[model samples]
Structures are given as C-alpha cells and as structure tokens.
Target: MPAVSAVSAAPLPAPPRTLGTGLLLVVLVVAFEAMAVGTVLPRVASELQGLSLYGWASSAFLLSSLFGAVLGGVLSDRRGLAWGAGFSLAVFAAGLLVGGLAPTMLVFVLGRLIQGLGAGGLGALPFAVVTAHYPEAQRARMLAAVASAWLLPALVGPLVASLIADTWSWRAVFWGLVPLLALIAPLCLWPLRGPAPRVGEGSGGAGLLRPALGLALAAGALVEGLRSPGPLGAGLVGLGGAGVVLTARHLFPAGLLRFAGGLPTALAVRGLAAFALLGANSFLPLALHELRGLSLTAAGWVLSLGGATWTLGSWAQAQAERRWGPGSRPLRVRVGLGLMATGLLASALAVLGGLPLWAVYPSWVLACFGMGVGYNSNSLYALAAAPPGESGRLSGQLANIEVLMVAVAAGVGGALIARLPLERAFALAFAVTLLAAVLGWLAAGRLRRTS
Candidate 1:
C-alpha cells in the first residue's frame, strides 16, 4: 500500500531470450526424476523388501538436500551461480546412477541422499538466476514459466514410470534420467556464465560449510527420533530439535523460529506448506492403495492430475500479476494458503470418515493448486525482501527450510504409517499436515508487512 521505491520495485528488464528456456529445461529433468520416483517408490520398496523404510527413501533425498542448498547458495555467492548450478547437476546425475544400480534399500537411500544434495543446490541457484537476470516485474511471469515446465513431466512422469515399472524394471527409470541430465546440465548452466553476485568481505559464505553439515545431521536425527519410540527416541528427537534450532538460526534469516515479521514469515509459510502438503503427498499413494483400495496406477493418476492443476494455479497467478500488478501478491498468497488449508481439511475428512473415493481427487487438486500459487508467491516475496546482494543467500535459506520441514514431515508420517492402523495413521498424518497448513495460512497474513 506504500509507494514502491526503485531499489525494491521490479523494474522491467530486457526480454529473456534463452535464459528462461534453459532454466525450465533444468527444472523439467529434476522434476521428472522426482515424479517418476514417486510413481515407482512403492514398487521399489516391494522389490527391495524395504516397505518399512518407504518414507526414508524420500526423506533421505530431502535430508541431504538441505545441506546441498546451503552449500550451493554459499558457493554461488562466493563464486558464481553457474558454478553452484553446474556442481549440483553433476551431483544429481551421479545420484541417479547410484540409485539406478542400487542393490538394496540402504544403497538406494544413499543414492537418494546424493541426488537430494544436487536437488537442493539446483533448487536454490535458479532463484539466484532469476534474481540476477530478471527484473522484479518479470519475476512472476518468469517464475510461472518455471512452474509450467513441470506440466509435461507431471502429466506423463507417473505413467511413464509405471509403464517402465510394469514392463521393464524400476531401475530403468533411474538409469534413463542419467543421459538427459548429461544433455541438459550444460544448457542450464550456460545462462549463468557471467559475473556473479558479490559477497561481503566478512560474510564468509565458506564459514557456513560446517553448519550445513550440522543441519543435515539435525534433520536426520529429527526424522530418526520421530520414527523411534520410547526414551531413546525422545532423546534423539530433543537433540535433533536443538540442533535444528541452533543450526537454522545461522543458516536461515534471523527470527525465523519466532516467526519474525516480513521475510521471516514468508519463509515460514513456505516451510509450513511443504510440511503440510508434501508430508501428506509423500504418503498419499500408500494411503490410496492401502486405505482406499486404489491400484498403483490409479494412485499415480491422482498425483499426475494434482500436479497439472498445480501448474494451472501457478499460471493463473502469473496472469493475475501481469494484469493486476504486484499489489495482487498478498491477495494471491492468502487465497493460495486458504485453498491449501481447505483442501487438506477436506482430504482429512474424506479419509477419516471413509467417504466416497471420488471425493479425494478433487480435494487433492485443490491442495496442489494452493501450493502452486502460494509457493510461487512466497519465492517472489522472499526475493523481493532480500536486501541488496542477499538474494542468493535468502533463496538458499528458503529452500533449506522447505526441504527440512518436508523431510521431517515425511519421516514422521512414514513412521506413523508403519506403526499404526491405516485409517488411524492417515488420520493423524493428515491432521498434522492440516495443522501445518493452518499455520501457513496464518503466516500468509504477514507477507504484506515484509520489506
């Protein structure tokens, strides 16, 4: 509502030529791998006889990515965005190889950890690219373009993986991604080849290296602690929580834990949405199959459909921003979070009450759509809030928080599903996520106050 200043306003930039296309390509490969993995993870679990560790398969990626994101951010700040982005892609490709050939669940998890590291890095650096290259005015549309990249993959990834899983082997899904990564990595890194952002003399981007590792440990401990029962579990949980709080304080913006106003609140909503939506998403396939009696293919379709709608919401937001201007962000974020909360609540109700199966599909679409809109808005808000020269670090911090909470949510939710009855476990999981969504909705209120 206040007058926008030149420093903060998203001035129009030269029209993006190849930069946007290359970045979208990068996103597509990563997204395909992710969506494909989800499609076959159940099969992977069954084949490996590691059904109990199903959540870890996904959590391991998220856990390691937390450190990867921080490392990437620092490296980008200290060196260049291209350097960070390239490194993450190489690491990600190797992870696919490792995962494709994994002989057991332990090995598979290791591969996931490696892949996550790259994903975290790749995830953060793109924002840096946008920050450095695009004007704030073009950011929304640019971000929407990035979101749209996921459309094709979302529409086909699951089906492709399912077909591969059914006809050939799950390993093919992993192996197949390797070559594509090889092709796209260079293109993705090309636009980033120029002067990098300047880091302050004493900012010591390198200094945070140790803290990144510490954050990863804390993440793992939190997941492990939640999974474990009894005194030992409680102790691990406590230790992990403490580590998270301590390490996060350094890695994230100040006052994140206290839900500090402005950028802090925006970051909170991002993490909370990940915690709420992805936590449930991680297990939704399992729930669909176990509780609702849907087949694996059917479950995969639900995920694909949800992804498409998420993209739709993202595009819709982009259009609104283009037409209505930046003033629309707060309203868009509020609407997105509200939809997310509503969707989560609706799903929980359907699951808990044993309603008709058809109801779940629409509920999920709403939730994903909410995420598409809110998550994208949060990125713009966070980037906008960054002080001059802090965009990369802030983006990394946001990514780190999002991945960390998702890891925790999935880890804890998976553990619950393993131990409890299907109905009760899902109910509790949805409830926890519902709580997270509500928290995010509350957090959205502060977005306009930032910067």
Candidate 2:
C-alpha cells in the first residue's frame, strides 16, 4: 500500500539490454509495416472502391489484434514472452503475405485480421519484456527508445510506400516487410526466457476477455454506422458489449470503469487520445487522395511530416520527464493533448475556411506530435503504476483497451466522414479530439495529484 516503488532503479531490464538492439529492430519492422500500409491504404481502397468498408479494413486488424494481445499476454504469462512473440511474428508474416495477394476487399480484410492477431502480441510484449527484464527507473528511457525507433518508419515508411504504390504496386509494401520480419523474428530469441506473472490473479473467469468485448463493441459500432451486410456485425457488437461489461470488471482494477483511480482514468484517457489520433489518421490520407486529388506520394509527404512531428513531441516529453520530477509526466501529457485539440481544431478551420490542402498539414503534424507525447505518457504511467510481475497484464490490457476504442472510432468516424462534406467531417473530428484532450487532462491530473 505504500507509494514509491519497492523495486530498485539499477541494472536495466535484462531482456531489453540483452536484446536491446535486436528488440528495437523488431519494433522498427513492425512499426514500418503499420506505417507503410497507412500510406498505401488510400490507393488500395480507391481501387477496391468499398467506401463503406474502409473503416472495416483497419478495424479488422484492430479487432483481431485485440484478441491476439490477450492471448499473447496469457501465453506469455504461461509460455513466456519469447514463445509468445515468436508465434505472433509467424502469424503476422502470414497475414502480410495473405493481405498482399488479396483479390477482393473481404479477403483483404481477412489478411488484416491475421495481421491484427499477430499485432496484439507484437505490440505489448516488448514493453512487458522491458519491464520484466529491467529496473523500473530504466523503463522511461527504454520505452522512449522503443518509441524513437518509430521515427524511421514515420519518416520513411510513408514516402517508401507511396513511391512503391505509385510506381509498382501496393503489394510491394507488404512483400518488402516479409524480409524485415524474417530478420526480426530471430533476434527475439536472445530475449525469450521463462514465463512472468500477471498483475493480479488476472481477474478470474473473464480476465482477458475485456479486450475482445471491446473489439466486438467497436466492430458493432461500425456495423451500426454502416449497417454492414448481415446481422453478424450487430451480433458481434452485442457480444462485445456484454463482454466488455463483465470482463472489464475483472481485467481492470476496482474503479477503472468508473474512472475512480488515477490509473483507470489515465488508461481511459489513453483510449480517447488514441481515438482522436487514429480516427483522423484513418481519414486524412483518404481525404487527400480521394477528395483533394493528391497523389499517394503527395499525401505521403504530409504523413511523413506527421510522423516526424510525433517523434519531436516524444523527444520533448522524454526531456521533460528527465529534467522535471515524476509529476512532469502527466503535465507533459496534458500539454500534448491540448496541442492535439488545437491542431485538430486548426485543421478543421483550414478545411472550413477553404485553405489550400497543403495548408492544413501543419495542424495534422501537431496532432501527430500530440499523439507521440500523450501515448508515451499514458503508457509509462500505466507501466510504472503496475505492481512488479504484472507489467505484461497491465500493459496488455491497456494496449487492448486503447486499440478497441481506436477501431470503433475509426469505423464510426470514417462513416461520419462518408456522410459529410470535407469541412463538416473534419469539424466533427476536431470536436472529438478536443473532448479527448479534456479527458486526458482529467486522467493525467489524477497522477499529478497521486505522485
């Protein structure tokens, strides 16, 4: 019950150090794959031309990834991060190959589902490895470095994918990643060790189910928005909603659902922050290419800036955390969200004011910077708060919950865009981002006081 960490701040997690370079390489390939696809997605959809299913394309990856993360955590807790990560890598690669060759939109989605499944484990496991292997004090820097790895993909992935899609085929984007994964998988071997324990007894019956439910709910909302082909989506939503209620109770702490604790509030804010960022990300490129008539390369340039800005923001956050005390963490996070709200609002204004398409990018860059700062703050906060041995459970649940919100927001937000003019759609996105900022401030405030 005592506050300050019982764990020492020395001897950084053995796993990341032992596997530092290798694990980072793994993170880069994964980040690159995700970033690259974002660049080419607009072109892919343009050719496939299923405007209604656009969100589903991304959500398929998110929803399956939700389940995959839960499964990974449990497996990591049982089989260890090494095996968990390795299995995920295999699945992830299969998904890319499958997606690259998809003839139809539905099949393409199937590939995304596979990718998501793999992603679930891929996304959270590294953080867990870092936590379990290193000292608590080492976490902030290691996590930042982990984040910094994204810098390259952000800077390069878009432009690379854009050029490939324009010159050759979007399929090249996936094909190119195959080798990256092939190399990254083996590097995990040095880090793979024995199983670590969960944060708690893992909540009883529905421990890991919360994320799936969240995914289902998100997909359901998308279905609600689209009224997609059959009732399957609705059914999925109902199941997800019910599961969210029951499983969340077990997955999170006592007051998470109610936002009573700083941890719960912080985690919730993280989800909203993700919603604001990802919903816009899902829409922006499409807006540029589909509506504004920008080529993939042109649109990618905008995305590259956003990625670069994200890194700058993260760098700023890490610097602030290091220079200031622990309280600085939430403060930086709040600042990040405020910036996002401002950026999104600015973009909305530009669109409404009939500003040139190129003019709106500065705001988009700010939004991405906000994401980098806000996400890292929330993640570090969550990981730091978790009891030792529970890093995997806590981080896994956090990742799952956040992604579920993102998937739902994308589907719902994407559809809203389909219904509105460019300005109106962006206006809605701006409003959502603002709300997310307010929530982030409140959530972060809890930590500000607690620390």
The prediction achieving the highest lDDT against the true structure is 1
Which 10-residue span in candidate 1 carries the lowest summed lDDT?
1-10
What C-alpha root-mean-square deviation, in Å, does candidate 2 show against the real structure?
Answer: 3.8
Candidate 1 residue spans exceeding 4 A from truth: 1-16, 42-55, 103-105, 165-169, 201-204, 449-451
Put down candidate 2 lDDT per residue, 1-451, tens digits, no spaces: 2342423355553554447777788888889888888767877777777656665787677778877877777666655677677788889899999989988777788888899888888898766777667665566677778878888987777777888898999988886688877876676766676554443554232356555556455555544544333567566556655655665665666776566656777678777788777667666766667556778667767777887788777777777677775666677777788788778777656545557666778988888888778778766766667665566666577777777677666656655576678657766765775676667666666554325
The candidate that achieves the highest TM-score relative to the unseen native structure: 1
lDDT of 1 at 336: 95
Name the TM-score of candidate 2.
Answer: 0.84
Per-candidate TM equals 0.91, 0.84
**What is the overall TM-score of model 1 with all chains considered together?**
0.91
lDDT of each: 0.82, 0.71
